[model samples]
Target: MKPFSKLREECGVFGAALRSGEAAGLTYNALLALQHRGQEGAGIAVAREGAVFCRKEVGLVSEVFDGRALESLGRAGLAIGHVRYSTTGQNICENTQPMVIEYLRGRIATAHNGNIVNALELKRKLTEHGCVFVGTGDTEVIATLIAYEALRAAAPSPDPGTAPADPAPSALSAPAAPDSAVEAAVVRAAKQLVGAFSLVVLTPDKVIALRDGTGFRPLCLGRSAEGYAVASESCALDSAGFTFVRDIRPGEMVVITPEGVTSRQVLPAARQGFCVFEYVYFARTDSVLDGQSVYQARYEMGRMLAAEHPANAEVVCGVPDSGLEAAAGYAAESGLPLVSGFVKNRYIGRSFIFPSQAQREAAVRLKLNPLSFNVAGKRVVLVDDSIVRGTTSRKIIASIRAAGAKEVHMRISSPPFRHACHFGTDIDDEKALIANNMTIEEVARHIGADSLGYISPAGLKTACVHGSLPLCMGCFTGEYPLFVGRHTKTQLETR
Candidate 1:
């Protein structure tokens, strides 16, 4: 089988509950709002009285969960949900998220939002200890590790037959001995795990939210009339009618229960390396990440790209959704006409599901049909967020040429991806990256574009003015913030 082309984003996790009742409906709503983050699969898990009920499938949230499944998942005061886009693992039903594990003590259902760099090593060690895995996914590996560590913490007294103290119905009280014990167990487990992760776990007693020490991914807290919610992106909270409270601090764990929300610091705050792509392409335009609006960031990128690479063209067009904002900025700066050259099919859910390569190519055409009238005999400048493998750019150029464009100049908003990213953005294997092997001019000629240019790394830094903290240009510059070995097929498959 051919290696799959990697995209730039990963998954989204949402967990919420109303102290009054299970948040099945609200979680469903939140997942719907976060569906933009992942379209391949979705799942929801609800915990009630030490037992967990879950429903998941390989499809969009609407396709997977209906009235029947929602009712079946039923009401537990605690529920966690996930939408997944496969990064390292195969896209299968078993890999769909919110993995639930039933242990000797209680049940834990977890949904994770980022990739673990040392997942394969951890999996190997766990398997040697007779840990059986049902799914070939990194999220499952995390769930197993957390469970293993929790069990280890509970050892020396195998059967501590004490029930966790129940909180008062109306007042917030100190966490019971069991709650504190489990919290310590999870903290110890998290310390052992490395790489990028923003996780939400539904335990029998509370919902725990945790972010990695470096804050590689974004996670925020929100509040609804029913209760508090935690999600990967703030836009989901907005769509679900929740007020944005604040972002979950890096390395912080906040446990929400009937007694109210309590936070504990598992690790001290450090310089955050949130994925810059979140602002460029991944997040919804309306979403604000790290005190900046995604739309504004892209707009600034476009303006900066225009200043760096001033192109003379009759019309400027972006490659569908992600590129649209930058294209608008380019047109505004270059004094060129901005036209909708391509019309995207909003109904297309997942781009990877097309039956064959030919079908996938055709799907691209069907997904974004070009406006012949807008490009005929005109010089067109195409703007896109980034070029991953050059396949998409080649096909897009073909579309523009087929539409009778005389000249096609390609402009990229972000610098070329020359290194693999271990912090959530799904860039895998430097050998597969076109920029790593070929220069910009070579890639332009290979893709049949007249000219191609990328925004300089300096411009990327200048786009953010308020802070002098350095951004992770690892994918562009091959300088990683964390040490990550070159990823191999063996490692990805086994993990």
Candidate 2:
């Protein structure tokens, strides 16, 4: 809860399948562990006897689901959950996940993390073909696609003489097993999807998960005592009593049923494009993603920052919660004493509550206080993960000066966010990013720091242990790995 700066999580997803009892409780717990990913809304949905039961609202997970509410979901064979910070949609109950629907293949409760670049086009096509739309969010679009595809996959061929008299094909009926039919439908829908996504689907007999071919977001499988669970981060799985299984490969679909786990590769694995922000800010410090330790990556980023941009200071301090590990690494590399600069108020939280620009600007002090004893009269080097608009960083620097620090040099661990993010990390407007407009020198003056330095893209990659994987550095380099829309390409046209 410390380090009350602003970095947002686009969304988080969790699901469990083929368990003995109600899985909503486990889903709820997973959401708690992932609460950092979002705070605007929360929901959980369960599938029981070919029907879906969902309860959701705009609030924190604890505020949305209580013991009584979890009890209401009752015992179910499968369940899926979601916590979201909107990037492509507005905040509304209708937009909250998991989006449940009844199609030809019984019913399903679906949850998703990441934005859909082609959501508008797909929704338009679905509507032209007679699919009635309810919510404006992309999750609903994905649900509808799966429903229609499942219906098509389950539809029996026109055996003119032997065609069934039924008006609609029963999704659970012959040709293939019901579970298999649902999974095929999911694969079909996933193929049509374009952009970042880690989807969790709940059917009557199985729980299914699908990750985008690029793997721009994190998704992993875990083995629980009762069954299998999937989450955007393994820490959540660990919190839910699931042992870490390997991360689900890119473009892979993993199905968990009573028979255990099964998987199929839908897309040819091409280049891997994981979000570097996960290691820097989105994921918990204790979690690991894509074979790299987030804590180690951050620690190394600090060490690398110290090596590349050593600051002349008596002591080094980190912006709590986010920059602590890196500060330690910086201290180790520079051989400077590490100290706590700010004490964060755990009671205050989740920046969205301060809606207005003025309110948000003032919130910095309400959440963090510079410790005079730790920083007084010392030339201190302040290390932070990233500075979005430089608003809070400016305020924090002013506070440190007021608290008696002789000189405050700001050291950032990641490259500047110069472009908008389209695949769901929540910085969609380029103008809102300070780095897009300010030079390194200009930014330092604006933030009231003696000097400022950000980790170079190459340095950041090295710190994260990035090897041959093709990373999504669009926000930094303006070079998108894959193209989705003309507008998206045009925005990153400078590179």
Candidate 3:
């Protein structure tokens, strides 16, 4: 296996409703709060008196859903939204979600927050059976699978007693009844899926939220005076003025209607394996996942790293964004002066769009400018969340050196990534991972740092304070929690 490299983000899903009025605005607000989870695409799906209307585009939520688009989406009692980061395929306009599928029974709009590992295999099977795909996203594969199962479940049986509820002739073109038949069909379809996923589906009459058995991603439920809401993070719900109800249990499926919410178990309960990286890198500091504060967890990680690898340096600085909290913790623990060594340009979006290596390097300069006063003639301890390809780290280190730092030591908060992640995380092939190609000493030299250290796997687990559950540390240990095929070679060749 090649070394694990930084992968793109999966996506974020948000759904909401107000009992008294339209939910499009609330859903928009929720999407904005969850925007950190993805930046490539955004969309909203609304249902008004059984009619589903949607507006989606390839851009940030603020750019995609303007007044005109919102007006076209119209008012609705229920709405579901999505912010996307491509994991399975290239990011494109057609791949923006929440994907709306109008089936024979009713219209269903779905937004998903994780990758389905077996999606390619399932998509092939479905395609051979005459299923047509509109986009190259895994969410579409899931939607098509559900539609197929629902249609099969709707088939008339030789024994009338076992037949699914037949739609009334007058209601043939309307939404199907939200009865056991439809729920059973959903459960059956869910069973066929493999990998991490937290999904919210909007039907003509109800909203359904489901999490994979292992619960690798976070999904929470909330309530407002209007109705119920489901979001990828509690922060989004809080921003949208909803009270946190609870997290969707692992392997649990929930259906919410005007009457009440119903729960069903599609898989047996097992040990929870929520991703520890959510606290370290993925989730926003203001959010909580699996009952743990993301900010606190990251702070603890920095504290632990300092205890393990205290550096004698004049100033301690962190990489922008993800590493800031950890740097603070390191500074506090090491009693080193915390200084802002680099000023990051808040305007730059994702790094993938920088057309060339020189442009990408220039982007780094534009995104972060070294503060001469902070590092001139001083020994610097640089704290970063992780080092994937070592490209960004190399640039930052060179910049710090150029700013007159006497010596620079790099400290990483997470264990070295040695294997690829098959879950929804964007870790690509292992060959691109610095840890795979170079030892710690080599990596230090490659990045032009005086010294380097990484948090041990044990340290990471300790930081999360998750004792009862096992973590999927595949990226660090090369031991996958589940069966992921031998595609690493193929992935590497393509890369």
What would the C-alpha RMSD of candidate 2 be, to one decimal place? 5.2
- The C-alpha stretches of model 3 lying farther than 4 A from their native spots are 1-7, 154-180, 350-359, 466-469, 487-495
Top lDDT hit: 2
lDDT of 1 by residue, 330-402 (tens): 8888889999889888876565476687877766687788899999999999999888888888888998899
Ranking by lDDT: 2, 3, 1
Where does model 2 exceed 4 Å of error? 1-5, 156-177, 349-360, 466-469, 488-495
lDDT for model 3, on a 0 to 1 scale?
Answer: 0.78
Candidate 2 lDDT, 145-193, residue by residue in tens: 7776664555454421122232343332323336666677787788788
Off by over 4 Å in 1: 1-6, 152-177, 351-360, 466-470, 487-492
Estimated TM-score per prediction? Answer: 0.90, 0.91, 0.91
Output the better candidate (1/2) by lDDT: 2
Q: What TM-score number comes out for model 2? A: 0.91
